[model samples]
Target chain A: MVRSYIPAEFIVEVDHEKCRRCKRCLLNCSFGALEFKDRVTPLHEQCVACHRCLTFCPEGAISVEANPLGFKYSHNWSPQLRKNIWKQAETGGVLLTGMGNELPYPIIWDCLVLDACQVTNPSIDPLREPMELKTFLGSKPDFLEFDTGADGTLRLKTKMPPQIAIETPIIFAPMSYGALSFNAHKAMAIAAAEFGTVLETGEGGLHRDLYPYKDHIIVQCASGRFGVHAEYLNAGVGVEIKIGQGAKPGIGGHLPGEKIGEEISKTRMIPRGTDALSPAPHHDIYSIEDLRQLIYAIKEAIDYKPVSVKIAAVHNVAAIASGIVRAGADILYLDGFRGGTGASPTIIRDHVGIPIELALAAVDDRLRQEGIRNQASIIAAGSIRSSADVAKAIALGADAVAIGTGALIAMGCRVCQKCYTGNCAWGIATQRPELTRRLDPEVAAQRLVNLLHAWSSELKEILGSLGVNAIESLRGSRERLRGIGLDALTLDIMGIKPAGR
Target chain B: MKNGRAKINASGIYYRELNRMIREAIAAGEQEIELIGVNGQRYIADGIKQKVMIIIDGVPGNDLSAFMDGPTVIVNANAQDGVGNTMNDGKVIIHGDAGDVIGYGMRGGKVFIKGNVGYRVGIHMKSYKDQVPVIIVGGKAVDFFGEYMAGGILILLGLTCPNNQSIVGNYLGTGMHGGQIFVRGKVEKHQLGAEVGIQEIGPQDHKLIEPLLREYCEDFNLDYNESMSRPFIKLVPVSHRPYGRLYAY
Candidate 1:
């Protein structure tokens, strides 16, 4: 048997005078960090800085601070590296984590600056101008056909692909109900519906109550095919085939049988206590041709509704996207390595998959070069942080952008990265009824609406400064962006010139 | 037949036009449809949940009856790949042999194949609550039968094996964690995946198969009692959580 040892990473500083010995922290702490040997003792070793105790404490007498364990830190073997090694050596288990990649990789969205017109081109005032931002996402025909008769009458005969029109370019990414609380999903669904956009019902099955908002919902059919039925397939404006996730590429996920409670059981259409596993690779979809079969199958199911194929942003993402478009996908969603997750193996979340910026640029370039860019719309996901990021994504040729972690932040996620424990004190990611109830769906939905409204306004501000009245004018206009700290390969890949050049 | 098919000659018609005709017919409250000269027309009866019937006189293309609900599809001739793919609450009957990955991820309903099936049949087939999917092939099945099958029933009958064919090919039920697979006659030890173990049919097993066998025989004009008289081998998962040992604490 292996012995256990872990250095403390947080110090709980408490005001004994204010502390009423209530021990609220002890009960609320899901990490088993707080204890009461005598009068509410603080076990700093187990504290993960989730701040559940501090928030729940009535007297507000407790606060946590980082324990500066400044070991002889080598850049190669940093404190994180050493601690991870120690934990693995002792536990003999694969490290599990929640949320997105925390590795301090380059955020290319920040490096590229948005361009504005000053002298030559006149700026349009968003308050006065129309500033059309209505965007329709789906496939488009290569060319339009026209019929001219001898009677001097001309008519256009073309059938456009099915698309969902959103007033704004921001779409809420797929966050499962099991991974996130029902309240969180409700908030997302409500806000998206109110905003005329879609909130993707992650691979989790659609709940019965959420049926009213099906028009604003995008159902996902992953490897597990959980809760998939005729009504579920037809309920959404579009259906997404989740081929892969960005955070943990080539890795399947298992929502433990314990999490399949009464409501989730009904939602996922699984037995009350049964493990739901999304296999790493769909057994039937061994090749691109197989992928085509599945795509056409879904298209046949929903006759006219558009179908999206979601895949991770791996090194071969461009080639994969090309195949998916050829396979008759209406939309292609690329999730970068920094994409959020309910839970994933720590190794794959950090080490696998590529960043979204390079992936988007490469895919756009490849599709354009192949002359099939019009065949499918591209939605870039992963770490879309701010309005600037959205503008830059559009300039990089994305039809739209999907945000998951950002929406969670709007719903009060602290980014403490303990979502896998399902004790999220902020009430965003957890299955426990009491913890989940802490989040108010109505208020959360309002907050999300506010966030999207502010972001939309900010996007208009950027467009106005660029002297453009339509959001479509900004798509694929890489000349409007300039790289600040990006290297030659990245600049070349992103199709952007250096800041000074 | 309570819902007789409204016959439509589909010779030289594009698949999209044929599907359009079907949709229009269904919208007009036609309960049944029959497609003649159906050469490689895909996505027939794809997702109509109403209680309807469709009959195909010729070869149907891939993904026939995909995501279909409450419809009975009968293929008089050979059927291609991905028949009954992800179907929910329906029946797909194929008279001739079918291609790969039949009933992939099917959640409900039944698929009855009167002849042989290609590789990877019943892959990822699952069931939820009272919805149990069942697939029966009259002839032999190739490799990877019931792979990753979380729930549902897959029965392989080797009555039509021309050669002294193996009951099922290699890697059978490779990642299967739930559900039961019954094979007629024999299955070699090497053919079984590590996660699966074979057992002699118990009284309970016999009880489960009896109803299914009776229904299958009646559907395809075979004798149920005679089919059950033959010996059967059942394969069950070694553990509910097949990958339990893979992950660490």
Candidate 2:
């Protein structure tokens, strides 16, 4: 099928007088979009318009010219496509995407809509009403009892260790240090602390600047086991072992050596200029039993701090999650296939794992059925676009929701899909000093905070309409969900009945 | 004197009593402890640093030796997953079956299992000269047996259950650059990586096995002579160079 050729969105022009022909731009471009014709570089029509050539030109000869008159569309699409075109125009860089399948596949978030409050139940205004978003992430005691010591003073016998408290259920998902810029991580940390939530330092070790936000941070220990030590383990309120990521299921992470700066090198405890590779599997763990050993080891090391196990939502994710909970994890962080990544193979990102919505529903149902739902708290992350997705996730079985790509979007990421190149224009995904400076942590943090506040308000509104005052009440409450335009098989898998049935 | 004995009386629930008991044991400075009355309590010896000996009579829960250091955990019954995870220095000996990731990211110490182990036994077991870790499996293991093994020694005796003939799953040594693996069977359908070299276990090989076999038999009470009678195969890296033939440059 030969489609009509469309003109490039961005055309590169080289200044003849300033052209040095060092060929540095050609060497750096992973994508073969640049070619040398008579020792002068020419941009090919296949360019995705990442603008790396323009930015890296030391001679200051290259300039990008956008076509004022956009290419004519052969097939007329919906209003969403038009909006996307305008969005692409606003940001000259190719759409930088995080999180899963955005193609017009059926979104379960839209299928499960939130009901607005009516006259029967007064809708409390968020401005005046006190909406509770506090969440506790840890095991809860079945019953409370008092034990009398020899001294006759009463002490709680069945008290559980205190859980890390969050003023909001929303949290920043773990995006590795190499995947996003240091400034981006700072933004997330500052914003999370300000919002009384928590931000995760992905598999990457916590930066020195982020040490102050220790109370609001969750450090992750992954398969590579990078930068993990007594201090790193004890630095955060909670520690998470990253079993897998949503964007690339069954695959480990590889941070190209070029991205490893001095600070990143120090923080991660890896040699400078070495490709930081996370092995596909953690060597110590061979089964569910081994997972338990690691869980306990971390627990003991940190004096019983909350330990979370993060896994991608695969075909048997429910069963795997059940095993993880049985393995003694305090929290289960499920990343749906559509989750975003700083750098993942295109094949893995597009073709691995199930949707977050389905995985969450199935896992919740499985856990509840097995009577182990209370063993661990579930935090769902993938492509949670709006507040509606958050509400749906909680209703489907998640105790809370985590935002990654959405948070990046809030922090001026245009989803240019050039993160793999390490020349991010928005300064969110690159390590280059000049590029990274574009994203100011202060401004970025404020934007993130604003986005989270809006989502929190929307979540409260949804809970209010469902006759649930607290976010906790909405967790695992499948009664509020109904399938729409989905097949019988999908509906069954999701453990929900079709709408109007 | 029997001190630091933590008793758990549940199958799946991780009660506060168990946590308190473990905490008290640590606080009391008891180096060696025995956890009795355990029937699959999750996170049994989680993150314990004290040089302790935890002898579990019944089944222990998940994450048995997470971040464990300088201790010997002996599980009498079948154990759950994530054993010896990120363990710097320690030894975990399972009398019965062991779950997945038997020695995941184990920087130091050794893990010995008397019976069969689950998948990815030595997934990322790296060695730093004097800190080389080892995992000796008495019985067969599941697939992806030694995926991404950078260092350490993984010994799998083809002693499968009476009903099965296979010792390990397919892709036995994928992405393995360093480390030595000793398997007993012919490894017929298994695929090995380019960086691996396979050879029949000769007289010289038996010298290496003598000490490991003696230790395995001593720990699990097996007949060393009977175990050594079976045919064995040795797996070594193709070259001493760790980063051999990965890139064009």
Candidate 3:
């Protein structure tokens, strides 16, 4: 150690008077922030403030807070920036972090507000009247043709492509099994099965146990093609070609060998303790035509299973989405900058990619303008916090929205941003058996189900208030939305009117 | 050889129906199946977990035997891109040259290409337990051969090429963290990737290549001794975890 200059970000404290000496806090602290030295002692430097010790402490005798050793206040040279500089100076390496970006970027969802029915139009009550939240994700024909039979009965003339039906428009975003614990993956799978929605098997291959919930799963084929076998392609209802991720765009993924344990090795179909690297670009896909080839190849492999192309919400997202739809993608998944990740360079996570709201609006507008809106359904994902965000996403031309961090939070993830260390206290992002066992799959599944149920009800309430009986009525209905604090240019890009107008 | 084999004419037939026919034929207890006129048909024997053998008369399109666990596919003509992609266990014997990105992320299988191959072949090829993937090319290979390879073996034999022409292209084995590559001819340092280290083949390496070359020679109907006459050089990863130290916790 060459004299580390980095200061402790958090300080931990133990209440001696209230401490029962049970020592559960010491066991619960996965980051090694607590130890028994005659009494419960705190290693403030090691503390990540995950609140695991505080939550598990029987007597509620532990507390954690941001370190009060304040630096000279300057907006340009903030404490975090100085700290990051110090860490880099000592390590001479790129700073890595977990979870979503912590930067205070503008959250577009907050500036946009939904319109409710006034006295002129009567609002429907969801309790009395049916509000349809059933969402189908896939390509749809622009028009339907009916043929008259000899018996004078009408039959369908056009052939229908494959579509995936979900009970609600909310889906669980792609979270790899290797990045997250097996129990966490299981919880999502169970919840998706129970909730009648879908969860994506990220770049990590699907485990044998998750085969039972294959119907509700969307297997992803990334640049690495880790666990993507023919059976894995056909295992899920849909196959998602992961072009780019929101957290770290224009980069590849490397699941460190330390995380590649026995089960993950088997699941990923690679040797244990070997780094699994996903190249930045698919080796075969160098152009739009190459992308088309891959999409068609997967379609040929799975036979009619809907294919989704997922890309980060970047500056040319609308045009990229147009090409993807033209390349025969049944669904388009746009992940925005605030999206969560297992591990990424802190700079990339905080700086790369655009907001999902703008990307969704632009893509939807472009597709509709090109008369190809029905060619592929859109799924907007990033920081979808609540049902209001979901409703807003639908109104802005998204057929559905996916939640990654929200789902983890439901399973007791405090977003401590230490998943890169593989010592997650919540048993969500770690592979350590002891830490992972802390999360009970059944309980976590129920909690996730409850969250989805609550959000679905709230979405129904929003639909009833909007005087729309079906959620489909809100799809691309920009008139139902208004910008409160957004500028004129932003409003024009989003295709929404100002608050007063 | 045609006896006890089920034949399907794939002319003007879509890839889906051709593959479906192959699957149906296999399901109906047809051990040996022959596909004629396989012009640009893709995903043959894809994800098929069987022990049957399929013979292709014409050129097959991309992703032949992709994710195939056990079946053996014999292509009489040149094979297009993505041959044996992410395949777990199987054998793809191409009588002619194959296209790019063949044996990508291939876990276990033997792919013998009689002629040359395109760029990025055997990229990200990995292995686990008893599953060690091997790609043997009798002719030259294009750029980025075995890029990002985690495990497995890639053998390049430029037997038919002129001495003036380079056997392998530039950026060879770039970003390779695992696995080994053996070239039967001389390769300049400029052709090698920064992550790759070249050395003379050892006895163990020779032992491994000998059997694989013998099999390749048998498949293409060439003399095994003639294929092994040239002195070989081996390329291995400089580091098992190439980007391990690039980040700070």
Candidate 4:
């Protein structure tokens, strides 16, 4: 029996009169849902309705219509049944998605609500209240002292190392050159420079075009060690040695030779159309001593750029983080399991590492116990959604936060999860010329700035109600956080007291 | 060689000297020049235009012929990784073993390595009409040989390795849907993708190897007759059935 198919979310529609039959819509559609039948374009039932084609149509022919009424199903099992149908229509396997907050698992954002200013305490106006958003992102000193030089000039002698000052604590994470378009990378870099923060160039070497903003960039050195030269190492504000990524923790990435175009090849310093293979293990690094060698090698190469080591939140991550801190690293970036990726194997992304919340708490507790919490600053990534998560991460001992998926969403990503295909409909993930032109660097940078501004305002509101003015005062202050409806083990793991205690 | 008389003392002085000499020669429309530098400095003769000859004395740094259009760089010593990355047209003759990613993503060029090469040699190489890239590795390669190769010719001539030794490593030609890989030695226990077809080298394959062998012999001082006497194995992608029945219903 043939079943009649009906779509619930018809977020995209096309006007036949306005379509010039130029096939621009077909090229923009990553899902291949649009096709020309007998010279008339038709939208298939398999459309995710991302609205990318509608926005790119030059003739302004596309319009979206909501599903008609009386189409709703009474059975509770209907959503799952419809999802199965959609999955079968697409890959005939399981439906794959990219860059969205996971839904099935309980989202921590929804469980925790921000406390607002009440009548008892003066609720200052958001515009008038002096809120501090300045965040420092480097190692701190243990003791403070003063010394007098021979010239009798009073000089403060302390081991307090310098930190990166951000007007807002939010930063754009490194997504790499091959994963996203150059326009997208430029947008993030420009936005970070404007916002008084830093942007990360993930593993891919710093492109020559981005050299002008070297002071605001954080260059990464990963396992493949692509595009790493003396000039590139010294060009950035900090150097990040990527031990593992949140998307696929142990697995390495392979950028197929077809995607290695001239620009990407030059930026990565590899051959064009050659598979950019990031090896699983760093050949020079076998132990912590070996890791120290690489760290000092880069430091010696670049003359004291703040060196950071980023690792996925795996088993025994606390112990590993301690080793990394003692290995002469200035910072530690911990990525959780639910992080997004441009391309990762289906098996690895689903089941690999621990949650960021638990990992952050454990690492903080371990560092505090070792009396070395001040040796390295902590930056938490992987599924940071709203301003509350940022505040919560700070309370859990994070000096700052890095956002990848959230930043992409602010730049107009629907999270269709087809990033591995390198045909991103929103012009955020692909290297295709026509699709990449859709994302304007200036406009996208504004959207990022706008998102950060809104989040910063929200962060101030939450901090004022908690009776704190600065973010530094809330570092590892778990007394302000209380868990709701959490079990004993979960409460212990999160290191938070239950509500109404 | 007028620029050779100028003494360069700095560490990264080779690239500046090479660029200045090449740019001056090209601006005057001179086609032939010689670079005499034996230092292990980086990025020598990078981004040179088509129709020029650069003879190198000492070892060069990583990315020797990066973004080279149509110039020939003849190296007297061993070179580094990313030898001919994104090179549109040129020839790089190395009289010694080259580093990793040799002929990486090279669309139109000929790289003749007189000795063995490192891992991932000829990775992602392709060819267009009248723009074929040829990478002839004179000795054994390490691993992942021709990985994700889409097009072009990758010839592995096991001239330097001991007898009865395997010329390539595990996962040879992984994800290869196009191009041809010819190995002169026995390929034992190597995993080939389903899209590739392996067979014994035929008479036509010998004809193609003859000219390349002659070029290798002249460049690296080897006997062409001694190199070609051994049996050769040829690898070609199964064009008719690229992927397999797995993707087909």
Candidate 5:
């Protein structure tokens, strides 16, 4: 399979005059892209632009310059498209990448404009007032039962539907130990515990070290059913039945055997060097009734633990969400096509599921119209980057939002999209002991906590500007949002009005 | 069943309530319990590590001992689907025939089935450290027996079969990665999955097979030597990771 290779997209050039010849760049590069021939030459073809060697160079002598080699440009045949084709043609393999979808699709979050209060309705001062981000997510009952007390006063029913109360609605989304590392899981768990939120243990099974964070973890029972035992199910605030993920909606996830190293072998309870493949659909659950059966099975196992169903934001997400609500799901998590993954095929990542904004709005409107909005709290996820995006999601009817790529960024991910190679220099997505050891749980956890705190403060500020003291008031309040540079259809589907109306 | 024990009259389709009652009783320090009218109430003894004895009179539902650890569950009648799914450690004794997919992903436990099991039995079962799952089915098994089994022991004794027309069904042990399947009687060449092939029982295998069979015969009230005298073959995965060749770099 000797095929012609394309020149590297970005080439690292070393200034000869200031080279210093310390060889720190060659020593720090995990990809071995830097060659120390005469004075630290670079085999740029292997460089994934991880920014590791460049960032650690003691002497400011190296720079990564984007190659001027441009392909024959066509609207349909861009440089990336040509490069991808050439790479596949050379390797004859399915192209694997990481991080969120990088397609230039319409970002509705940027188009959404948040409304502010004026003259008659003055904005609340968040600093002076109690800007409560406190949220209770669960099924809210329709009517209250009043019983006469001994004092001849009416009292409501003593018991109410179960609610998962958290200070902020941001949950640490499920990222598996095999895909990432134990340190990453610890970081997420530590951050979640500090932030008074939940951290999910993606179907790779909870590491033994994370058992201490049991109260803060959400164990996922996906199709693989790896390392799932009675204690695994019980050791969590909730159980998430992963029906599908957003990156590759219909396809399953395959954490290659190379990634299933020593610690992961014990954590996932599978043999070392065995692929941790999550089947696309659960063989036990073939239909909606089967889904209900498994859901109840988990409920039966955990008793009263909150059970959530995570589905990709597909075309019929509303109808599917209705069925999920009817099936007694306390929470429905919708992941858009832009959702990140450790490894996914290029085609599915680029074109598969729908956007989270439209899906959230549609499901919210459908649930409200069907009068089952209170039955399940909607948590939107995909590419929720900033607190303003979180506010937009809340206004569009998401009770809470989850972040994956944003969390990785907080943990020092440069979005190099080379995570599937198991050579992540940032120590966030790789499982190699050397790379994994580079990530300090304490430091990453503190950074994540700071990011979440900043986002929470920004959320409170946005709520105050909207004249709402609590996040609940802005929930499903589509009138508080206006669409900018959006088509009429998109605006209608999103349940928002055009600007200046 | 025992003194100062708890008993639940599970007559309806309220598995949640039944499980809650079982949990409360266990939490209240009741070790031995009995459920009488257990007809298709799924997840009977799910996700519990308490050292208790649960006795069931009737047919328990699907996923009988799913994720169960440490408890000894005795099903007097037949057991249904998904017995001992991803089980950690426990003992499940079924007095009668069991349904499909028994011991699915069973990590560590002993599932003694007295009758024929259905499709995909012991699928994706794995062993971790010293925790090896052991399943002994007395009767014949249907299609895809032990499909994609990653670890543990699967024994199928074709005791009640009329004739030897491959007591096991088609596509037996398909995609089996790691595990040993012992079946009585001869299986046709086409009946085997791609990743597995049958070989004569060796002396080293006898050590592993003898004790498990002795226990199975003891539980079913059968002659151990007479059962062992019959022709037996062992099914072992050609490789630990069978699909490794397809997608490896």
Candidate 6:
């Protein structure tokens, strides 16, 4: 075999004195980095630094660290650039990556700061008062008409559109059952059910086991239409039409045939070991009118369930969102450039879409300008790290925020960025039976539940400090935000005042 | 009134109300139902998971029988776009010409069109276990026929088209991966998509299509012998995974 130019990214060190000869780390290493004949040997080249072995080690014997002698250091030609160039020179293929963009792009969420009530306006204590975090996702009427009966009871004259209520304005983003394990999916489902939020069944259909939790599930229909039968459409509380993912905009998803096991095959409604390719564009939907047809067709199928449209935050996101709303989508899901994915081209994931903060600000401003802000609720996603980020999104006019990587972190993902390799050591992103069994659904569910509960509490605290009792009051209240280090143009576009102003 | 079949005049009724009325009639134990006027009404038998038969007189609109399961819909007139879209366990019979995107993502259904079909017909039709979708057209078909088809059978019998004219259009079965497309007439090599390969109909292929052709003849009142007189050619995907080698890993 020709000598490979690429060097190993990590170095595995085993302290022989501390080793107890149990070889627990050897068994737990999913990346095939450990081998034992007479003694446990480290194949540092295969190590992904997932920390699974480190965490599972019975004794303090193993330590994996970044290779200090990675490359000849050059400020202009960084190690990453040199590595990528060398990789392409060897493989002549697109560099595939898992998870969100790891680029050092400016995070607007960090640049913007929230406001707190001072002496003039007294802040309320969440402990003593009831703060409403509950929000509904769906289109709302511009005005409500009530009829006063002779008995003095007021009757609602206007018909209300279908809405799915969440206890908190935080939801689990779309993560396919096939991409993750059954245990991971179950954990998210149980957590969403316990938390009274929703989890999306990413284009790869809902599993039969998740049917009982259908009330908190939002079934997605992408270009591929995998496992989307009439029953699947009506199984969830809402249906989402996935147009584009933020990680890889303007491209299709290809779940390789290797990942198509018997169960995934059945769930996706394809033959075993066949590539499930979702075309970039829904062939039938060539225009906005065609999109409207599909939206209405789904509405007809599900009868009264709300339909959401998920789109990557492209340059013209505001216009696209407007069209989506006009095309009868009840909920609009906006995924920013920093969105997570099971697998995507590294180039596209880093360079394709805009930030969620900018997209949310633009779409909300446009919808409000057009007087159709009430036509559909907006859910912003892509690297919403904390409850503070969720509050900031709501203040920027998002009705809710979706968390994907954060949720996976709650379930023990170490952000190894090797999900596509099907060797997720934490068992959160892999489908291998042995690795998947590592994640206990009940335990992972409890962790997710705790994370959401903590975030909810923090949201309430943020709301109380803002002198608002309900999350709705904070929605679209841009005056409550101040741009810290953002330039004048950026602040103007986001419609936020400077920190001192 | 005829043979205990419930009849409804869908004139000037909205699509939603008409569908609701159809459901109500079915719930009321109407075994076979018929509608008199269905002009431009969309979603005729959409998502109706019943084994009952629906007969319509006037032309139905787009997305007819979409996501419909276990219901047989017979249209007396031409059907619009999106027929049998993502359908499962049902049958749709369109008497006249049908529009684009017919049988899209359809699984476990049979759609028989008596006349011609528009572009992108039978796109992404998949099969899972016992559910294999089938779409047969008696007349000519336009471009992108069976594009991205994953599974099931598609037969095009262009018996009504002129001898000089092409039976199928360009870029046939463009991204097809796991299905069979049968054409009754000759097609040029350039007309075929790069992902598909043309093969002479084998004995097994003949055996499989014979029963389907007989059923199509029965539905459209055509001569089975005459439909089979012309030599047939089968188009299958070159590889089950056309884009497998395109990626690095």
Please give, for residues B103-194, the per-residue lDDT of candidate 5 as tens digits: 87788989998887888888878887799999988888999898878889999887777554567899888878788999888888899999
| DockQ values per model | 0.57, 0.20, 0.69, 0.06, 0.48, 0.72
Give a tens-digit lDDT track for model 5, residues A1-501. Answer: 564566787888889898899998886788878887777888878888888887888788888878888677689888887777787776677777787789999999999999999998999988899998988767778767889999999998656877777789788888888888788899999998888888888889999888988878889988888878877888887889898888888877778788877888988888788777666777666778878877877887787677899999999999999999989888898999899998888888988899999999999999999999988888899999999999999999999998888998899888888888888887888887778888999999999999999999988889899999999899889999999999999999998899999
Q: Rate the local accuracy (lDDT) of all candidates.
A: 0.88, 0.77, 0.92, 0.75, 0.86, 0.92
TM-score of chain A of each: 0.95, 0.81, 0.99, 0.87, 0.97, 0.99
For model 3, state the Cα shift of residue A253 in Å.
0.7
Q: For residues A250-358, what per-residue lDDT tens digits would candidate 3 score against the true structure?
A: 8889899899999999899887888889999988788778888789778877877899999999999999999999999999999999988999999999999999999
Q: List the residue pairs that clash in candidate 3.
A: none
lDDT of 4 by residue, A178-223 (tens): 8899889999989998888899899877889999998788899876
Candidate 5 lDDT (Cα, 0 to 1): 0.86
Q: After superposition, how far is residue B20 of candidate 6 from its true place, in Å?
A: 1.9
Interface RMSD of 5: 2.5
On residues B117-147, what C-alpha lDDT tens digit does candidate 2 reach at each position?
8887887666654767788998889877776
Tens-digit lDDT string for candidate 6 (B142-187): 9999999999999999999766678899999999999899999999
lDDT tens digits, residues A286-389, model 1?
89998987887787678768999999999888999999999999999999999999888898999999999999999999999999999999999998999999
Q: For candidate 5, what is the recovered fraction of reference interface contacts?
A: 0.46
- Determine which window of 10 residues in candidate 2 chain A has minimal summed lDDT: A90-99
Between prediction 2 and prediction 4, the one with superior DockQ is: 2
Clashing pairs in 4: A97-A417, A98-A417, A257-A273, A272-B105
Give the residue spans of candidate 3 off by over 4 A.
A148-155, B1-3, B162-165
Location of the lowest summed lDDT over 10 successive residues in candidate 4 chain A: A94-103
Strongest candidate by TM-score? 6
Q: How accurate is candidate 3 locally (lDDT)?
A: 0.92
Clashes of each: 0, 57, 0, 4, 0, 0
Model 1 steric clash pairs? none
Cα error, candidate 3, residue A254 (Å) = 1.0
Residue A356 in candidate 1 has what lDDT? 94
Report the lDDT tens digits of candidate 3 across residue range B17-135. 89989988988888889999989898899888889999999999888887788999999999999999888888999999999999988989899999999999999998878889999
